[model samples]
Target: MIFMEDVQQSQATIAMPIDRVGVKGLRLPIVVRDRESGVQHTVAQVSMSVDLPAEFKGTHMSRFVEALEHWEGTLDYHSFLTLLDDIVDRLQARSAHLRFVFPYFLRRRSPVSKAGGMMDYTCRVDGYLKDGKLTFTLGADVPVMTVCPCSKAISDEGAHSQRAEVRILTRFEGFLWLEDLIEIGERAGSCQVYSLLKREDEKYVTETAFAHPTFVEDVVREAAKGLDEHPKVTWYKVEVESFESIHNHSAFAVIESDG
Candidate 1:
């Protein structure tokens, strides 16, 4: 049987090139390498795009899904680079971009009780390739306990505290583990938040947070300082947002560096 006319590949009358055209929110179950788990299976919200030349009316959108399917092996920085190369070659585009957004889970033990629990963090890995070069960005949003410095100093008995999210985005040249990034955020906050905390653990976390009070500004600055010390990190952006315990509004701060 003969196929219908190829409209997508037909010549365009407009003759105007499109910068980026492809798919987004394509959810897929992918296997990624993890430092602790060795291999982790998770669903990734993928977005892939490529430049479209004026010569063609449109690109073969199915090619994006095909590329994802043909990729075999652990999803990682090196693999992502190779995948982008394949995409640009397949789509005949000068440049290509890919991003994966997912919730990555890590196991954590309670400080005092030692009870184990899985904690999820918002994470994203993005890459763009052009002119025989590729760049990747790794990002994570970490939740922690934050105690108000002012409240701790002013209050006679107890201090007000809240849950804070510290997000860090960075470009690194060598190997950098997700655990390392998570540790930086946990250390920068007043205290590390735990998913499972017994009575003793709760007391420990509460006292620890009260003793190690911090503001939103302090969280970002502290995280930035840590990222600066990492030799592999060539660039970084740190942001902290605190959900105030007593107030309705939230407090936030950010610090960024191009190099």
Candidate 2:
């Protein structure tokens, strides 16, 4: 057998420590809990890293994949923290970070039509482990419909209504489902958008938006209010971006809680 030299074990010449060193853009299949179903399968773009000491020249990149491959359980809040622990132990590091970005689907029934369709929401699960403490943040991007209040008041014909996205990131003390955040985002808008809408559903949504005209600022404020009212949510950040139909530029607003 030939002896192979491990270059990563060598001492670093720069004498500087790296905050994070690992892999990114790793695609993996994971299962998550669904409100209606028992579980749902989805693909995730995963990124994992750990703090590197000044003595180490580099981290073992292959170890990141190795650890992720061993993760076979459902991806949930508890399991997410466990995965971070596995990475930290495998890398022999003081701190570790893990992020998974995936598209979560929810079954929706169109209003007035009773049509069923799947709605996709971009979600992210993040974990940071340091000093034996773990911090978890869950984020979701929800699409909704919004009407301009100013345009509705002056215009005699119609109002400018467009699609907007509400992004919510929250840190909670207890368990909270992704649907919880998504519902808050949807309700914050003038009207909820559906994937499939028939003629009657379209009329209903259009009338709903016109009746509850709101600005982008209103969306974030409403989302913040929902998070604030929740007892389990310790901290939260809400961002609303509207793709204006009348203008080329998009309107956006952001709000964050003190805690």
Candidate 3:
């Protein structure tokens, strides 16, 4: 005769919540709409994240990469929203966030001779979703030539000229291309900078900027005006930074979104 002993089992315990979990600095190729042209191909550095509830100890890190792989080709407002929604659903989380930064090139025509060239602009897009509600933001860093107004006023011979970068961030209610923000920044500066410039083009840029000298503060205000008039943009922030030629420090100005 044989006998068997009874076994005891332990009770299950719940795990603690993670504050934030996701991926970062993921490089991928993407295509975006070019205002002058129809489409442009570029690479983007992307980041995605989601909030973890108090009941969950961790999130599935692999899921974020998997989601990105699916929609990494053609990126747009609609595709971005769909990706965010998928992340939220797949992770079973209340919120999801996405960020992408890329270099966008635009073909530009010379003011005088109408010579054509390409200018590269740094652009970024961010999206977030919570409780099925979504919000999207677009941004760009534009480089231009800024001739100091005060320098021009005080100096008799020549005014101080420096390279300035203007950054524009805006929340969009509808579709808006990165090129739009770039144009706003270019118009705000004394003159827009270019990647390739011949002697004639350089002369035109210098004279044009000297004729329309601007301060850092002026650039921010002007950029704000352009953003205000745009119908697709719901909110915006304009920032200008000039690399001072005389001094080591740079002059900067910022304007936040009120409308």
Candidate 4:
């Protein structure tokens, strides 16, 4: 075959730069360190992008996966940032972005039954690098039981309760884990949930949520308070959404601060 010119390297007449451009929704197995568990292996949906200069027509899409391979099966805060920076340098771009969304499993035992199982939390790690500075964000979605305080107070027999999730977003200067955010979220809800629960455990959780009787607003406020006090968190946002069992709509609240 005749040697062909590198089409992607050819100069563009329009010279329009893109803010972000590269691969997304890539499923790949990654190894991440867990503070308590030591190591975790999970598949992540990844998006890696680099700012395209006006001179360039396109970025080398395959380079994103090639960069991930350099991870050598492990990624932590330092390595994650380094990867983003390396991409920026390799692509000769002004900035780069990387995002990994995965299910992080946490082990939990039933409140009363003592049965144990793993529950997966929606977790995300995102990094953006520019001018030797890196801004990384850690996020998690934790599901728990929520009982409406208003329904509890008004109802004669029992209160309407449903599953709710607290999503926490944080920008930290130091190491942070999805597990830490999971704890904060679980505590803010009326009661924690378990993947495997016996009848006894179910009974306990039901009564516990009823006794707590928290609204979506309350959950967000409580989660925000916890994040605000976190020493490592430089900024934080907490959002709570409760699927109302009695109503057609869900209740939600959000709180944020720059710590």
Top candidate when judged by lDDT against the true structure? 2
User: Could you tell me how far off, in angstroms, the CA of residue 80 lies in candidate 1 after the best superposition?
Assistant: 0.5
| C-alpha lDDT (0 to 100) for residue 61 of candidate 2 | 91
lDDT, candidate 4, 125-176, per-residue tens: 8888888888889999999899888888887999889999999999987677
1 or 3: which has the higher TM-score?
1
Clashes within 3 Å, all models in order: 0, 0, 0, 0
lDDT tens readout by residue for model 1, 1-259: 9979978889999999999999999988888768976888888899999999898999989999899988874578889998899899889899999999888899999998899999998888999999878989998999999999998889898888999999999999888877778889999999999888899999999999888999999999999999999889999999999999899899999999968
TM-scores vs. true structure, each candidate: 0.92, 0.96, 0.88, 0.94
Q: Model 4 residue 180 lDDT?
A: 81
lDDT winner, 2 or 4: 2
Stretches > 4 Å off in candidate 1 = 1-3, 11-16
* RMSD after CA superposition, every candidate: 1.9, 1.2, 5.8, 1.6
Better of 2 and 3 by TM-score: 2
Off by over 4 Å in 4: none
Writing each residue's lDDT as its tens digit, candidate 2 over 213-259 gives 99999989999999999888999999999999999999999998999
Which regions in candidate 2 have their CA more than 4 angstroms from the true location? Answer: none
TM-score of 3: 0.88
